[model samples]
Target: MSSPDVPSMTGVHVVVMGVSGSGKSTVAAALAERLTLPFGEGDEFHGERNRALMAAGVPLTDADRAPWLLAVRDWMSAQAPTGSVVACSALRRAYRDVLRGALGDVLFLEVDVPAAVLRARMSARTEHFMPVSLLDSQLATLEPLAADEPGARVDGSASPAAVVEACLAAVRLRCDA
Candidate 1:
């Protein structure tokens, strides 16, 4: 994925984190492409009960998400040897910890998109289980990465290309550091 000038990501798992409709999946998939790593769609790891709850405009509690989070974490852990990129909401610090603690090095990319933009995106999208009504719940649950965490926050409102470049640049900076 990297040339001589750029450092190869030998042991870094990138977790694209954000609230629903924040472009976590889009940015994550693109970032994986640029890094030539395997992609894990976090939503695919959710259980039927969780999906039904979200589809019904119900916000998932921590208990509701625990197993699903663990599933995603374990998948990334398995891929830790080769490293990989995954898309997940990872709304809480604890949830992020559950993921990164299992892997040696993890970069959590928090995609920041405005509430209005998030609502618009969620309302317009039909293929996802998440409803716009749950947007506020997700936003309220989100905890930004702390200074001690290995990650960067990128604006998701930008075009996909710009967002991907920003993500790559963030990865470069974090990986180089």
Candidate 2:
């Protein structure tokens, strides 16, 4: 169901990444469906303790996130051979490196939105374990993808469809190269 103008995602494993409230889940799900690829929810990989910590407005230490990152890496690695997409907050270069190490040349789609939009989005969330109080920490930790990274950034303020299209285009460009 992808538009003809868009390139086919034959072997691209995409990580839809950003800080909290950047629409990673929405964009990643749509992008995966558009490409007809399997999708994984990064939050689902979090251990109960991590979830609890976040729910209580406590920021996770890198130590707390390490095992979670490995779990996400393993999940992405399993899907990489077949081409899939996952929604994750791989906010740091080191985290992306972990995923790249596992998947081998993964493309990251970083969704960047304005702080106001992020705060609004966070305020509107209900069932999510991540609280608005933790967004500042997440944003503080977010490191934009390095120049050498194989990925592009999309505007999170755009419509989900537009964002998905942009992501597909980015993946096409990266994979074609």
TM-score of 2: 0.94
Off by over 4 Å in 2: 1-11
Worst 10 residues of 1 by lDDT: 1-10
Residues 1-177, candidate 2: write the lDDT tens digits.
457755556556789999999999999998888788889999999999999999999999989999999998888777765677899999899898888876545789999999889999999989889999998999999999887898999888988888888888888788767
The C-alpha TM-scores of every prediction are 0.96, 0.94
* Model 1 TM-score, all chains together: 0.96
- Give all candidates' CA lDDT scores: 0.89, 0.87
Error of 1 at 3 (Å): 3.5
The residue ranges of model 1 lying beyond 4 angstroms of the native Cα positions read 4-6
